[model samples]
Target: MSKTEVNIIDPSILEDLCNNVTDGKPVNFELPNHGILHIDKLLPFICVYRYSELDFYFARVIKTQASYIIVDDNTDISHLLEGIRLIMSAKFETFLVLECWPISSEDYTTFEIFCPAGKAPSTVKALEKGFKSLNETYPNIAVEVNDTHARYPDQLEPLLNVEESKKTGTLVIGLGIPTLYKNSKTNELYALFFREFYSVFSETIKRAIHEFIRVQTTDDFENYLMFGKTNIDEITLTSDAELAEISEGMSFLLRTTPVNSNEEWTNFKKNEFKKTPEFKYRLISLDSEIEKRKLYNIPIDKVDDPTIAFILRGKRLEIEKQLTMLEERGTKNFRFVGESLYGVIKKNVLEEAKHILAVYPKREERKSKERFNCHEFAAHAQKELDYYNTKFPNLDLTLEIRNDVAGIMVSKSKLLINNEINLDANRCDALIQHEVGTHILTYCNGKRQPLQQMYEGFEGYDQLQEGLAVIAEYLVGGLTVNRLRLLAGRVIAVESMVNGATFIRTFNLLRKEYGFSDRISYYISMRVYRGGGLTKDAVYLAGLIDLMAYLKAGGNLENLYTGKFNITHIELIEELLYRKVLKQPELPRFLERESVKERFKKLRNGIDITELVN
Candidate 1:
């Protein structure tokens, strides 16, 4: 809510604000000028900044859960702050007033903490240390602490007298910032530098606030991360939706997968394993440059919450790389971009894949009398969807049988099945757990989240997603030795493709060295060599290995089910969940099975990826 343009803050407005603070309600209102007073909660501190024409971006970078007052010097914010101190001090028993002002110093320092002489030494030391932490992230931005003797800086009048601070039990620290994100010559904003500064500096402010609260207040804080903003604004949500829409417009896997897999395999077999087959890709849906421009224009800078800003910005970069990779498909540059996106096959992962292949010889897939057709598998998938729908009515997932798709693949909320597919009864249940239990389950769970990106899949989400799917197959007693060999063979195939091996050579390596049949070798080669040496197939075994280690170290499988995210995102997701910005996700229904629970117990206690080769 905002007020009409006024020369000063109205008395009645102050009264309403005081009442709200006293009653412990959220307070957000705009002042006469372009000033804003936003109090996320009635915390013990407030970050104050006097609005200036030159330093417009300063207020935008201050991110914290603590309340703040941003108004021009023309507005009388002294009375407004006095009212706040009276109520806030009475409520919390102690309050902190962190006031900020611009400095004209041309030194190398970016921030200076000014404190009154003969004041709380411990509080000053904590605040000083907090600002100093910024040096680790940005070593050149020097920060210093000084004793000003006076409560206010030289450029501004005192908001509270020293005696007033003692009486109200409030400690005031003045921050002298250089406004470095502005161009000195043209006086224009340096947008990129400002964004980078905002992402780092805002977290620094929170760390400083956390220090002050610990040294001065009665609250026992655990970590500075808890002080982050829990509320996501409308701008953040809108930007996420816009980006998700753009992401949905393109399918990375479909565009990258070879459309002529069957034809290519037929040609390769007819040539007696002497020739490399040509591959084809799907038509691009969106122009690469136009989509990249749209991604960069999403105004992610307007998002003040530092965590959300960091997430969105990183996602935009990932999407840009993906677009470039798609545009560079069928070229040498495609492999380089793919490596940057999905990462290259590591030495250890390749060694592990080779060891697994050497130890576990290729075995024939057990034949079954009853091989379920596409219609029967679709029926089983529908039953699994129905089970989840019973628990969550909003889980409306679709199962489609299409001729274009090869085998089973879960894309977004829909599960696509190839029309010519016939699943052996022995492996049918495991495939169900892999697709319906893991992929579709995570997608539906992500849909329940407020952030659209969670459902769309986070950057590098494919690794963890496939890892969990493979684990699901094992948990349901469907992880056959043949399946394990196939996963390992894919890794070897990717490593060979990355090492400049020809397709026919890689196929022969798999067939002669690993004992894979001609058909299996052709299939693996087709997947790895599709779209100019894709490296994503390597993640299946690598992710399973890493995920098993994570579980062995006591990481929660339930956390992995929160959404489609990389293993690296576990800590960030925990932070968001703690801050209440993200809700606790629902676990998959398969976890309720007695056998699956036993499997999880074994996994948590001690289970290696090699142990799952049953």
Candidate 2:
């Protein structure tokens, strides 16, 4: 018979045939290829059928047999038995079939089919055609038939609703009826049967679809059923599957080792804190020492603060003697002689000159115009200095012009000018009010006290000195954005050089990009970057920010000027001033308020008056 030729018998007829033939006797089915009968009882003569567009086949017994039957066919028997048991009510031990195909050698096929007593042939036809039609629609599928006797009806009910299974199983039985053709050649019959079998079974061909559905549905079902149950302490009903998943998640958490405890978190923060650099200066300790020694007549110990020690050691005895003599001379009035103060002016003169020369080197040997211009500017600066000195005589001031230097300070005899004037108008005013008004006033005030250290200096004084000076410029309206930008540029230039830029790079950038004249740019960059990683440029901007904060808090600029006037001194002065215990100095004879204001106005405006005054 051809492979496509299917025998679609009514399941009821097949069941009746089995009952009549068994009759408590053995039956044997003849095999076309001389195959042996493996069963002896008639009850074992169960029919195995596969229905599909690809191939169709059936096995039958002519006499009573044992518990099983063997058929030679070279086809899948398990799939055939599953489909048969699903439709028919027949019971036998087992059925084995051998199948031969053109592509390979002969192979044995085995199937087990079980059915109840009243199996109808129409039920078989329905199942066979249903599966075959499913394969026709979805070619890569295989049908597995099983007896649903012991299982609940609901199990098979869901499958019946599946359109593929119902339609294909029905089509396979109806379409496979041509296999009984006797005129057909054996090869033609084999091909026809095989083709029908494959078409019907194609619905169950690939396992991937069933596997994927099983995985996804099982997970969702488990989650839906087990969610709250897993958390119930008393239940203890977790499946090994759920426990295994939980264990894997916990293993991942352990591998990551996240910090959870409060102490562990705290330790992490503490470690980060330890990495920060400690502050170099502490205000409390320095203030305490200063306060402790304030009442004593003896000189402050030099080791207490190096900067203070340097200042006191510079002119301690002379300043002390001058102050004592003035107190004794009953010198309620005194006029400053600018020239007499030149001795002290000389101390910083060479340092300032070196700084200037470092910044502006002579390009040509003789009488350079830049050098001459610098000198003319200095001469002009001196005139203003002299004017301040002469005009502020009520404040015991004297004005004198000299070729020496251009910074000022109050001496027993006069307010000194360094005679060297920085032709830069902004720098000149900053120097005047900063050094003269604050430093000079503080000096004369210290002279009133028994201890000379008050006037000499304070520890960590540079920040205070520069800050006060810059702040004074702001008060006198000399502070300019250009000046601040210059300070900021110095910081940037220094940082660049520290990071390994060369002097030429620093100089060129400042001159070209920053618009600084070559002379000024070279000096400023050199001052910051030349001294082997010095970070001094950072202080100006830092000091200005600090001073602005101090002033904003309603700080008295005049008192800050008269206070010991050191960056180091401000904290204590602030305390004293806050407590209202701050003392003022006795008025000097020649320092007139109106004259000082006039001089300040000229100095503030950058007017050169030295030649005109002299």
Candidate 3:
């Protein structure tokens, strides 16, 4: 009947795919020994791959999984074709089968397009346009266009019946890519470059598919981003969990903060601020190499979902940086790694900090008649936790007043307080909201999310989280000029340290030049100089500046509460929430306050950082 003898695959496989697609459900499963078939929804196209000699290279390149089919042998090819027809019958008026293969070319990297003779010319042009446009990103890669009677790879008969395909509203295009990811002579893969190329190449295909859908089909979607995999696989989930496990085992901040902070400050001052203080950090019991090895063991490459893989890969790089910083602590390399991780203090940030130190008068500092000790503050913090527990019920938080910890900090889900901490009774509520309301609140929100990395803290999450915490202080009507000055002083101190200023020199800059009191100056210098000079303190002021601008532009505060992520992640976070991949988070407790509501209204209407001072 047809030129190519059609081999009928097992009917059960076709039945499973067709039934799920017809019912408007996702299909993800192995086609027995054929290969994997995953469809996020009823998209109008399918990216198909049949096993070949360049299996390793091609398998890694075709990343569009919204609707895809991969198979091994002749029987598997039959299954793939049948499955494509089944999907077309169940869901679409017009369909596209984008089959890709790898060609062994020792000369150079090129993409060759093979369009079947009968398809619309516009459709063929769209495919050629997509391949040609890759020149913008990969200028060295050449693109060639050709017409073919059969749209299939080498040594394989046409997988689809041409006459029947036309009647069924199906079109097929064959793409041949030279194996540029491997050494033509040795056949060894350039793994890192291949990964980068894979991401770009995948986007190219989606761009082509986007144009194809616009010209050929009436399928409705916003953009090529909709082609990204909506469903994360078991490999992605487990890999994320394993990386989070390694991150949780190492508390970078806690391990890096000097254990003998008070002693070092006292000795430094006792030495009349001449010699640099040697800060003693908490000894990491776990071997750094072993921990780094654990990070390496994560199978991030096995993850097929592009979005999730990108996020996970970023986290792994950050973890590796932290581990290296830990191993290099107390050495010259420590500060270099720290600068790379936290970022160097920018000129604008330094200018802003200097302006705050100059403009904010010392007279604006709050005058309090009563001061409370750590015990009183701990009691107040526990009461605040009690209030949140009523809302969340199982909100688990611990308050530990440790001798080693300086000031108040939230680590993991625990609020750590310095045993010798003294606070103005007036500012207690502000401190409570900053530590518990923001840090612990977001951590709790992250726990409810599907990704464990959210709870542990996504890479670069500190900036947004700290910025939101400072906003909490302002909302509770406790943000004071003195507190603003304190935050600004930290930025100045970090800038000095990054500029090669010694501890004693930075101490004098804060004390003598900036008019900071001895106690305030000592603490600021210690924090910046700790772990051989950290630039992290600058984020508080930097985050606040960026957040003020974000709010000025009408950014949503409720979205920041979704989980611990950087401001850069807003779009991706929103996309995930839109796809129902991430659960929508409830507003934080502080947002419920009438005072907070009034304050937020002003914030939304564009309030300046200086204007936020209570």
lDDT of each: 0.78, 0.36, 0.78
TM-score of each: 0.89, 0.31, 0.86
Q: What digit string (tens of lDDT, one per residue) describes model 2 on residues 95-122?
A: 2121211111122122212222233334
Give residue 584's error in model 3 in angstroms: 2.4
Q: Could you give candidate 3's per-residue lDDT for residues 348-387 as a string of tens digits? A: 8788888887787463544887998999999999987777
- By TM-score, the candidates rank as 1, 3, 2
Q: Clashing residue pairs in candidate 1, if any?
A: none
Q: Tell me, what's the RMSD of every candidate?
A: 3.7, 40.7, 4.0
The candidate that wins on TM-score is 1
Q: Where is model 3 poorest over a 10-residue stretch in terms of lDDT?
A: 1-10
Quote model 2's TM-score: 0.31
Tens-place lDDT per residue, model 1, 152-218, is 5565567778676778787888877776666555767878767766766666666766776777667
lDDT over C-alpha atoms for residue 532 of model 3 = 79
